[model samples]
Target: MKIQLASSEADIERCYPIVARWREIEKRSQFVRQIQEQQKFGYYFVYLEDDRIEAIAGFHIIQTLARGRVLYLDDWIGETSEYTSGYSRILFDWLMDYAREHSCQSLRLNSSVRNIQAHQFYFKNKMKIEAFQFSISV
Candidate 1:
């Protein structure tokens, strides 16, 4: 599999169906134009194998009061059939290498509470749950 920057409409289309499912659950277009606009300063990667999209991962380089300069992973989704098939690891490993090359302090992500399997994957991958994310809707 190869990781490539998803800049074209076709690339985004490849991710739309899978990401739309997540957007329905989350009640927002997590990777819409606003987020894509932010990609100008960061990275938006899609995994491809045999001319088909396997997964998508987006990250942004940002400075936060707590984490400072870090690569914040905004979203990741793999085909259900490909889940736990090592594609996720490959994508993450590529992101890690990318981060290292750019001198990022850390990689951060916010996983929704509903995504239990994803949490387990993160744990298995040696990622720690550093904090609980709380939110209030106005």
Candidate 2:
């Protein structure tokens, strides 16, 4: 399995549905624009198994006074199939290496409280819960 940047329309078409399983986007045209917007702040990557996409994630590297250099993952969703476990491990291990190589002090991400599968994965992977994520619509 390989993790590659998803930058083309075809790539987005293949991966967006998987992400949509977790976050609702009202329309495909809207999703395309959002992908462009996201590229300004983060990156979208897809995990591939024999030329087919199996997982997708968005992540950004930023410097903050509180955390120094950190890797912030915005989205991570895998095909809810039998191969999910292997795909997840490949993606996460890659991210771990990326964070370390970039000199990031931490890898942080926010998951909806109801996402039990992700929460459990975080726990098993030894990530600590430091604070709640709060947000409001503009």
Top TM-score: which candidate number? 2
lDDT of 2: 0.77
Stretches of candidate 1 above 4 Å error? 25-45
Residue 50 lDDT, candidate 2, scale 0-100: 44
Per-model TM-score versus the true fold: 0.80, 0.85
lDDT of 2 by residue, 38-66 (tens): 88766656445546667877888999998
Score residue 106 of candidate 2 by CA lDDT: 90
- Report residue 41 deviation for candidate 2 (angstroms): 2.9
lDDT of 2 at 40: 72
Query: Can you give the lDDT of residue 100 in candidate 1?
Result: 81
Which parts of model 2 are misplaced by more than 4 Å?
81-84
Q: Candidate 1: how large is its RMSD? A: 3.4
